[model samples]
Target: MTRVQANLLLLLAAAIWGGGFVAQSTAMKELSPFWFIGLRFAVATAAVLPFVLLERRKAAVKTSRRHLGLYLAIGLALFGGAATQQVGLQTTSVTNSSFITGLYVVFVPVIAVLFLRRPPHWIIWPGAVMAIAGIYLLSGGHLSALTVGDGLTVICAGFWAIQITLAGTTVKETGRPLALSATQFAITSLLALIVAAIFEPVSLDAIMGAAPEILYVGVFSSGVAFVLQIIGQRYTTPSQAAIFLSSEALFGSSLAALILGETIPPVGYIGCALMFSAMLVVEVVPELSRRRAQAV
Candidate 1:
């Protein structure tokens, strides 16, 4: 695919992801967070089962035991991130959750620097500062009274960054993004189920009550959005994909306003602008540098 096509796919993936946040928030109303996660991932795993089987049959993509171990480890990271975010969402507003979760944009570079000894461009630090400010404003400009959910979500962002980095490293080695995704979903489903069994009262009525929301999340968010993400990222650089995916915050906030009657304060608009500016800086500066080099 051309760069333009790749960028477009990334944008489309972001939109799908943005809408998934809305589904998650809606699902929270009738379902316990763990229960919802368990069901969502269960359905997602089921949705991808056909593809997994077909790939195994057609490509003979059998994972060795050693590779399976790595896949499970990646799945654990994914599960940890999702579980923490869901717990945080229980106590936080959807708008806050969206904004806070986006901190991964900043965390990714930092974690890469720390864990992988990857040196980020000089622009990344300044962009991260702007992103932090944007997050501050997005969280209603109240820096003084941050809650447990805020802290949890921030930690969740770090885990998400790690997951993305691990995915980049491992997906290439495995050449099995689809199969890896399936494994991750299955692992997440099982983990969530165990958590729910321990802490949540699972009842037939509860399941029935959450049926619609569960189906939406499972089918659209976990299953479809994830597949799109894998496909879209295949054609784009991680940096480009990150900027395009940041559109999720904008889309999520707008959807919340339209569907849930959630209102963004004036400060939230400022936050949105700052975050967009930061993304532009991160994405555009490098492109301009490359163009300059080409001109020389």
Candidate 2:
């Protein structure tokens, strides 16, 4: 797919994840964070299993040990991010968690530069600022004093950055986005389940109570959205991908209002504008610059 199409897919993933915010919140009302995550990813693994088999039936790319390691590392990062975000949400306000987690848009480029020695295009820097500012505004411009949950959410953003960076690099090399998605989902499920078994109490009744949320998140959020992420990242830089995906906060707030009767402050419109501008800059500036350079 073209870069624009890929980025659009990433945007679609963000919208799905935004809707997941409600399911995640509601599920935890009856289930603990670890159990919720464990079950959610478990269902995701099952949801993706059929497509994985189908993909393998085609011209599948061989995975080397190094490639396998990359997939596993992304899974570890996914587990870390997922675990912390859910646990953190228990204490932090939704506004704080959403704003802080959206900071991954900023962290993505920083991680790329520091670890991979890959600096993003000049456009990404300002786009990051705009996206983040948009999220901050979307959160109603008030970040309460740091709580333990807020701290955990900070760590979650770092893990998200690492996962995005790794996924972008690995999928481009391996050309096996479906395999990467399945591997990461399975590994994340295994890790979350292990932790849940050790620390969280899981009752069948509680699981049943949260079944709808789990199934929705597992099938769409974890399975479909994450697969779109891997596939989309193959065509875009991690920094650019983050710019587009940062719209999750926007979509999340909008969905929360629509689905759960949550109220959004008036400033949300400004935040939405900024976020759209950010995505627009990232999408259009590079092409304009390239054309200008060619003309000169």
Candidate 3:
């Protein structure tokens, strides 16, 4: 697919994820976080497993043990992010969880710079600062009284950043993006099930009651959207993909307002604007400069 097509797919994935927040938050009324998460990813694993097996048959090369290790690490990151966000949703507004999680766009570059020693363009610093200011505004213009859910969501964003960074490299190196996604889903589901079995009350009646939410989030959000992300990344740069995916925040907040009737304060809107602007600065400026240079 062309880059533009890939980006559009990413945007679709973002929209799916955006609405997924509602499913996740609503299901928590009837389910524990671990139980919900475990069941959701179990569905995701089942949804993606057939594709992974089909691809495995088509491709002669097998995944190495090293690649499996990488998949495990990626799965752990996914679990961290998903579990934290799930738990945070119990106490946080969907809008808050979404915007805070969207901070992963900012975290991605920082992670790249710090751990990978890759220097980002000059715009990254200003964008990061702007996003920080946005977070402050989103948090009622003060950082001192942030809620536990907010803090956990921030940690979720960090883990999401890790997962995003690893996904591209892992996919490229292994040449089995679909299988990798399926494996991660399996691992995350297993871990979540184990936790749910230990700490949370898991009941079939509850699962059946929340089946619609689970199916929507699991099949579409985890299975379809994740596959779209992997395919989208193959055709676009990580920077571009981040920008497109970051729209999940806006979509989430809007959906919450419309469906859940949750209203953000005016200041929170300003925060959203600032955060989105920061994302644009990071993604758009470089592309504009490159285009201008090409034209010249």
Report the number of the highest-TM-score candidate: 3
Name the candidate that leads on lDDT.
3
For each of the candidates, give the backbone clash count.
0, 0, 0
What's the residue-level lDDT of 71 in candidate 3?
93
TM-score, predicted candidate 1 vs. hidden true structure: 0.88
Cα lDDT tens digits for candidate 3, 1-296: 89999999999999999999999999988889999998999999999998888888777567788888889999999999999999999878999888888878778888888888998878889989998888888877877756889889989999998997888688777778788888888889999999999998877889888999999999999889988887898899766887898898889999999999998667888998998888778777877777889999
State model 3's lDDT.
Answer: 0.88
Question: What's model 1's lDDT at 12?
Answer: 76
Error of 3 at 105 (Å): 1.0
Better model by TM-score: candidate 1 vs candidate 2: 1
Q: Which stretches of candidate 1 lie over 4 Å from their true place?
A: 1-9, 57-62, 233-241, 287-296
Whose lDDT is higher: candidate 1's or candidate 2's? Answer: 2
Worst 10 residues of 1 by lDDT: 54-63
Candidate 2 lDDT by residue in tens digits, 158-275? 9998998999899788766677777887888898889889988889999999999999999999788977987898898765786778788767767766776766467856866776
* Candidate 2 stretches greater than 4 Å from native: 1-12, 93-99, 127-147, 226-246, 264-288, 294-296
- What tens-digit string does per-residue lDDT give for candidate 1 at 75-183? 8988998888888877776676777777776677777899899987677889888988887887679976567787788788888888877877776676777788789
